[model samples]
Target: MKLQDSVIAITGGGQGLGRAMAEYLAARGARLALIDLVPEKLEAAAEACKAAGGDARAYTCNVAREADVEATFASIIEDFGQLNGVINNAGILRDGLMIKARDGEISKRMTLAEWQAVIDVNMTGVFLCGREAATKMIENGDKGVIINISSISRAGNMGQSNYSAAKAGVAALVPVWAKELSRYGIRAMGIAPGFIETEMTASMKPEALEKMSAGIPLKRMGKPEEIASAAAFIIENDYMSGRMIEVDGALRL
Candidate 1:
């Protein structure tokens, strides 16, 4: 798909990587539908996209809710007239080990709420948004792309049982959607990002960030623009479906 004049919808577009991607793609001449929960952040991100050299509109949405996703995508298509792509980028982190024990004795276990919260936002939200985007794209006869933002933690990370599980689920959907949507000229892909310089990671302690960065082969965290560049490449390349592009500076979980 060409970036020029393309209509791309992004979840979690209020800030961080989602906003970075919106600006990156917008600069390439694509129109954007920026979706997020915060009205103020969405408006700011939309304005930023417009300032980046393309048109953009803000839509407040809760991607985890089916009704919100359906309505948001419909509105995107209604407003843009043609849907070209969507990025399932909305996610939440509920970090905790499933079981916390001292000396093999019972201590604390991850609550159901912790697990469910992450699953609802990260995994279920991806499914809901992907379904709505595909439906809209098919109805409009647009050859579009769906990019799911997975994570290196999908490989399984300590202290992140819920996050890892949700990430893994989204990663698995890439090939499934690619095969299922191929007939309609729609492509599906995943991006498993390692630690990056986002608001979430930026809030970590300096020593924690330094230690984490040292573990990566590149000895530094990735930039949001780096991930955004990978997303842009996926949208621009026609035959790059059913696979994930990891932008982790060669880091592995």
Candidate 2:
């Protein structure tokens, strides 16, 4: 679809990859409904979008909650008059080894709560928002695109049983949703990012960052804008659906 005049809703648009995408899409002339947990951050992003010459608004939402997602969409429809697309970009990280033992005795294992928390936001949150957006698209009878933000961790990473499982589910959901939604003229896709230099990675120790980058064949971490660029491409290109575009710089990790 054309970026100009398109109504695009983004979850977690306050910061990180979400914020970057909001800025990019806004610059391209899309009207935005940016949803995030932090109202202040959303406000800040809204200001930036305005500065970039785009029509934009912000909504504070906990994407993992059904009430919040539904309410946010209601507000979006009220404000934008129509909803054409969505980016399920809200996610969280809670990493831990599933099993840790010394001398064969189990010393540590991932807690169910830890596992559930990540899954709730990363996996289930995607489902809720994607479903809501698809329904709206169908109801409006508008051709739409839904982009789910998956991660390279979906390939199975150490010390991230919860995150890995959740991400893997996200990747799987892309194809399933594509099949189901195709009949309605809606498309679903996923982006599995690898080693992006965002706030989370910046917090890691310098040596640790070096060690991680060493694994990437390009010897570098990806930028949020890189992922945003990929997203823009997917949304504009109608033939691309049920696919997971890896944004990693040849990084196995």
Candidate 3:
């Protein structure tokens, strides 16, 4: 539970919330094995973690591909000796209306590519990493934690049919996995974050961002460190499992 000298593998640890989480845990003396598609970003993150006084390494991986994930985990285990926890934080957004007409009129009908792409990374990627992490934890007979990064959109967002469905499915699996893995001393949990001030949202129009902020009770976007703090809390609180914490500033979205 304590991050000090524990091994943790974080997917998409290059930027945004994942990067922040990596830094926070690393500062607590957690050894890190970070995976990301962008080598440049990963380099920056790795440097930051090392500067924070932790052992850290980076690997390029595509979580959507099981082969890639398996190989990357193998490399990580080889390098770190063993892992105490894993953070399934890798995700991508392909936001669009399920259906868009030639005139750009959006509808409820989603395209196969739109659905599959999001599902491939957001859903399937989580599944692959969680499975691999659980297997390792169980096989090693070591108590560990598995944290799945979910989203506020899981409850349902108008243009996020694919993202919403995938996230919802992920949240639904938390309890099931926790019950199944509890015997092995492996805890499962989910974190649903609201509008966070990450690179992904930096492109939003100021007016749109303001409108979104107004919808939240706190009236502003959250910081990546806020979510990272929640991650640290969950990992340290041994009894907190099979549940989700929403770090969305009281925003329903």
**TM-scores for candidates 1 onward, in order:** 0.98, 0.97, 0.95
lDDT for each residue of candidate 2 in 149-177, tens digit (9 for 90 to 100): 98898988999999999999989999999
Can you write out model 1's per-residue Cα lDDT over 111-226, one digit (the tens) per residue?
99999999999999999999999998899888899999999999999999999999999999999999999999999999999988999988999999999999999999999999
Candidate 2, run of 10 with poorest lDDT: 133-142
Which residue runs does candidate 3 get wrong by more than 4 Å?
101-109
Ranking the candidates on TM-score from highest down gives: 1, 2, 3
What local distance difference test score does each model get? 0.94, 0.90, 0.89
Give each prediction's root-mean-square deviation over alpha carbons: 1.0, 1.2, 2.1
What are the runs in model 1 whose C-alpha is more than 4 Å off?
A: none
Residue 25 C-alpha lDDT in model 1: 94
* Total backbone clashes of candidate 2, pairs 3 or more residues apart or in separate chains: 0
Best by TM-score: 1
Evaluate model 1: give its TM-score: 0.98
Error of 2 at 21 (Å): 0.7
